[model samples]
Target: MNILIVYAHPEPNSLNGFLKDLAVETLSAAGHEVIVSDLYEKNFKAVADRNDFTELNNPEKLNYIQEQYHASKNRTFTSDILEEQDHLLWADIAIFQFPIWWTESPAILKGWFDRVLAYNFAYGPGHYDQGNLRGKKAMLSITHGASSLANYGAYGLKGDLDERLFNIQHEKLFFCGMDVIEPFIFHSSTKEDAKEGLFNDYRKKLLNISNEPVIPFHPLSHYEKGQLKDQYKTSIQQELEMS
Candidate 1:
């Protein structure tokens, strides 16, 4: 299978980078074609701009933007933002590798989503309410500085790390019709003692993705019928208060 590994880390010598290398090497050694988008090395921009969205109606006036977009279309994109889309198109599975900063992804990875997963490419209520980018699979390979318990419900942390990513990784990706694959988290990846073991585990997981069961979204029957609005409202209020 063809795999695309999107790596985001400012320092190439960081633990996250080491895992990126391991993942790439392991995948290639297993006979899978791998593509790496090193956001920092590629100098990816972390912000979206007018050119990205403004050229939607006119293709002619969008000279530079079109070039970038086409490069992304054909897997030849050199610009950081557009290159991601191209890589996604060429891969069978998309793996995002990054260190969680402030309980979220690095700014560049966030920007990659902001720019690459655009209106027509990712989603819209039109087009039969189906997304343009469908039928793909994705997994997140993340590293965190904190201990695993810090992200679990037992310790009163927000919830499981998987729950925190539901909206972005699973819901968003699956809503766009991609088969949401289980994520691989390198808990406490920043610690030296844990790094080697976590890296080895991650490599094994990626290599054996075909054997893992694809987790489906929770059934709607699991939610209360009339209490949905109230529940979300309360959750939003609590989140605002905490923030």
Candidate 2:
């Protein structure tokens, strides 16, 4: 399998960095062709602006989506954006390795999404499960500062980790039609023992990625006119008989 690991962490000696290394080594040893995009090391840009395009669709006004759509159609994306997109296209599996910051991925990684997942390529009309990246697989290899219990259940301080990551798993990867794997999340990874445990678990997960169960996302067929089909309503919605 062709794999791409988009790694985001400043310190090479950090826990996230170590996991990134482990992923490359383990996957390569398993006979997969692996590529790592160390965002910080590459000094990737995190903000989206006119710089992404070589030509403007409308010089009088700046609409990023419009410009991106035009650029994508005309093959005018900047060199950096094109390079990342090329890597994305070459990979069968994409693993995002990052430490959660302020409840989401770091700015650089987020920016990578903004620029690389271009208009008409990643999403537009008939997108989400029908997007250009269909048939691919994606997973989040994440690290969190809080303990597992703190991020669990109704009473947990951080609520549900799944809920927190819904945007990335459901909106981003699923929208692009990639089978989203259940994330490998390590909590309170500051300790030595925790690091060891995380390493072991991650190695196992990487080796079994092809067989991992994908997260269940409602198919496009489950919606009509932007509303979920009647048979697909949640229990709360069913009880309330929401119209």
Q: Candidate 2: give its CA RMSD in angstroms.
A: 4.0
**Clashing residue pairs found in predicted model 2:** none
Q: Candidates' TM-scores?
A: 0.74, 0.92
Residue 1 displacement in candidate 2 (angstroms): 0.8
Q: In model 1, how large is the Cα lDDT of residue 13?
A: 90
Residues 58-125, candidate 2: write the lDDT tens digits.
98889999998898798798988888888989999999999999889999999999999887877776
Q: What is the lDDT of residue 204 in candidate 2?
A: 95
- Superposed Cα deviation of residue 234, candidate 2 (Å): 5.7
lDDT of 2 at 21: 91
What do the candidate models score in CA lDDT, each in turn? Answer: 0.69, 0.87
Query: On a 0 to 100 scale, what is the lDDT of residue 158 in model 1?
Result: 56
Query: Tens digit of lDDT per residue, candidate 1, span 90-118?
Result: 88888888988877898888878777775
